[model samples]
Target: MTEMRLTPLQYMERVAAHFGTAPHAVFVSTFGCQQNEADSERLCGMAHAMGYADAATEEEADLILINTCAIREHAELKVLSYLGTLKALKEKKPALLVGVCGCMPAQGHRVEQLKKSYPYVSFTLDPASLDKLPEVICTLLEGGRRRFVTGEENPPIAEGLPCARRVRHKAWVSIMYGCNNFCSYCIVPYVRGRERSRASGDILREVETLVADGCHDITLLGQNVNSYRGDCDFAALMEKIACLPGDFRLRFMTSHPKDVSDRLISVMAEHGDKIAPHFHLPLQSGSNDILARMNRRYTRERYLTTVGKLRAAMPHIALSTDIIVGFPGETEEDFNATLQVIEHVEFDMIYSFLYSPRKGTPAATMEAQVDAAARAARMERLLAVQNDIALRLATPYVDRTVRVLADARGKQEGILAGRTDTNRLVYFAAPEEMIGQFAYVKITRAEPFALRGELINPK
Candidate 1:
C-alpha cells in the first residue's frame, strides 16, 4: 500500500532539494466527516514522507491546506470565509502556500471561480486526488504555477497506505469509495463519483497490520459502507475482519437504510466479541411522501422492520441516525411524522440538520420549499425531542458494568474516557497508561451524552 501509483521523477528531485534546508511545516484544517479526517491523515502522511513537519497553527506553516467539506451550504461558506482571511497571509508571505481539497474543489464553480477570486491560493485538489498530495505540495514548493490537480480521477490505492493517524488506538479503514444511491438531496454521488470498493485482501491486511501496531479500535468508513461490493459483500467483509486475530473492536458508519441487510445484522450478532453493536441507519424523513420525494427507496415500515431485526439481534445496540428536518415540500404532517419516527425508534443519539439544498441536487428546485424560519424551528423541536429520547435510552446503563476501550482523557480530574460497545462515551477514573487499553467500568452517573464510570477488575 505504501507503493504509490504515481511518482513524477522531477517532483521527487525538487522535494528532496527543498527538504535539504528544513522540513516544511504543514497545517491541515480538516472539515466535515470521519472520511475527511481519514483523508487528512493520509495527506499528512504524504506530507511527512515529503519531509514536512506538523505545524501547530496556520500562521506558522509553510503550507496551509484546508481539507474542506461541502455537505451543507454553511460548511462550504465557512471554508470560503477562511480562505478570504488567508488572502492577507498569502499576500504578506509570498512563500506561504494555500491549498484546498475535499468536496469544495469537487464542486465545479468553486474551483472555476477560485482561479480568479483567490490567485494567492496555490492549488485545489478534489477528494479523489488525495494520493497526489505529495506531488502537489512538491510542485507548489518547486515554484510551478500549474494549480488545480484535478479532473484526473485518482485510482484506488491499497489499504495499508501510510497515514498520520490522529488516534493511537482508533483507526479508520475506508473499505469503499464514492456512492451509488443518488438521494434527491445529496451531492455525494456527484462529487465523489460512483461506488468503488477496495479489495478485501488489502482491507484485511491493513487491519492485521494495524492490530500488530497496537491499534485496536477500527471503524470501517465509506459514503455508504453497507453497500460495499469489493471482493465480497459488506457482510462478508465484516465476517472476515471479525475473524482476524486481534483484540480490536470493529465499527462502521453511515449505513443507508435501504442497504443494511439482515445478513449484516446476523454478522454483528455472531461476532459479538469484535463487532460493536452501533447501527447508524439514517431515516431522512419518516413520512412516506417525503421519503418518496427524497428518493430514499425505503418506506417507514421497511426502515422499522430493519430496526426491529437489529434490536432483536442485539437489544442493547445503540442506534444513532442522521436526520434532515425541512426538505422541500415538507408539511406539518411530514415534520410530525419525523417526530413519530424519532419516538418509535428511540435513537441513542441523533445528528440532525436543517435541510440546505446543494446546487446540483433535484430537491433544490422543487416547489413548496420549506421556509427558513420553519426549518430552524423544526430543527430545534427535533433536537429537544431527541435529547429526551437519548436520556431515556441512556438511563438503563446506569450502574451497569460495561467494557470500555479507553480512548481519551476526560476534562474531569483523574478520569479517562472511552466508548461502550454500543458507542456510548464512558469516562472512568483510570491512569493515563490505560488510554489505549480496554477496561471494565461500572457506570456511576449517566446523562444524554456521556456516562461517568469507575474502573473495575475484569476478573
Candidate 2:
C-alpha cells in the first residue's frame, strides 16, 4: 500500500478523533534565539489547527513539545536535563504525546539518542520540517509508533505558515533562513542548511500585516540577516519595509561584520525615522589571528571600520554585540585585544559567553584548546569590564526624555515596562491600559541593566 499524505484539515480531523470532544492542551518549551521563538509561534499555530489549546504548564499538557537548541553544548545539556523531568510525566500520563523539534533534532546522533533513550517522545522534527508537524502528530496517533522526520537536504522556504505570536505588539519576521558563513566553531549552517532568503514581496506583505494589526515593534530575523538576497538584497528589502506606512520601529540582528555594507548603512541612515537606532553586529573576536582561525571572514580593523561607518552615520545609535571569551588557542594578548575593543566601543549592551566546544566543529578538534577554568575566569573578568562600560553608557540616559513602547508589565505593582528605540529597557509607573501603546518617559535614574523613569504622558 502507498503511504498517505494528509492535508491540514485531515490532520485536524485525525487529532479530533483521537481525543474526542474533550479539550486537549499543548505546552511548547522553547529554547534558543529569537528565530527559535518565532518558530515556536508557528508550532503553536499548527497545534491550534490540530485541535489543541495552549497549556499553562507542562504537567497539564496532553502533548509536550520541547523546542531544542544546538548552538552550544551547555544549551544541549540543559535540554537533556529538562527532558529527564518529563519521563515521569510521560509515565503518569501514558496517553500524553511528547515531541522534540528544532536544531537538536536536525543532528543525526541526537535523533539516534532520542530513539534509544527517549522512547517516551512520540516524535522528533527538525526546524525546516516544521510544516510537517501536524502530519507527524497524525502518524503517531494512527500508526501507534514514534516518528523521526528530518527536513529536506536543501529545504525550500515555507511561506504562509500561520503564526500565533506571543506578544501582540511585538513580532518577529524571518526575512531569511540558515547561514552561509560556517565560522569554524558554528553549527548553524550544517543543521539549518544553506541560506535561503524569502522573496521581498512576501516579507513586505508580512510586515504590512503586522503593522496593520497594531504591532509596535518588528524585528527581521536570520542566522546571518545582513546576507539576505532574494528578489532584492537585504538593504533594498529594509527600504521597502521602512517605506510602509506604520507607527512601528524596525530592528534586525546577528549581522556578520563583512556583510554590513556601506549601502546598507546609507539606507539605514536615510530612514532613521523608520529604523531603530540600534545595531547588533557581532564581533566574535577582536584579534585578527583569532578571527582568521574562526573563519569570520573579516579582520579586526575591518570590523572596527564597519562600526566607525555606523557611528558616523547615526551618532546616537546604540551598539550591542556578542563576544566569545575563549576560542581554541586564544592568548592573553588576543583576550586583551577583545577587552580593548569593548572599552573602545562602549557598547550599550554585551552578550558575552565562555567558549564551549561543540562536537563535530573544527574548533572542537583543534589544538591548544583553552582550559575550562581559564575560560570561566576570563569570562568573569570580561563581565566586570563590560558592566562598568554599560553603567557609564546608561548614566547618560538619566534626565533625558525618550519615547518608549510599553511592551510589558514591570516587576513592581502598578508599573509598566518598555524599550526606547535604542533598545534600552525602561520602567515607569503607568496604567495597565498603557501596556501596548507609546509613552513619553522622563528618565529618573539608570541602572546597568535598565532605566527607571516616570511616565510623562499616558499615551
The TM-score values for the models, in the order shown, are 0.94, 0.96
lDDT of 1 by residue, 4-83 (tens): 44563344455767788676788999999999998999878767666678999888888888999988888989998989
List pairs with backbone clashes in candidate 1: none
Q: Which candidate gets the maximum lDDT versus the true structure? A: 2
Q: How many residue pairs collide in each prediction?
A: 0, 0
TM-score of 1: 0.94
Model 1 whole-model lDDT (C-alpha atoms): 0.86
- The alpha-carbon deviation from the true structure for residue 87 of candidate 2, after best TM-score superposition, in angstroms, is 1.8
**How accurate locally is residue 68 in candidate 2, as Cα lDDT from 0 to 100?**
90
Regions of candidate 1 where Cα sits further than 4 Å from its true position: 1-14, 153-160
Query: What would the TM-score be for candidate 2 when compared with the true structure?
Result: 0.96
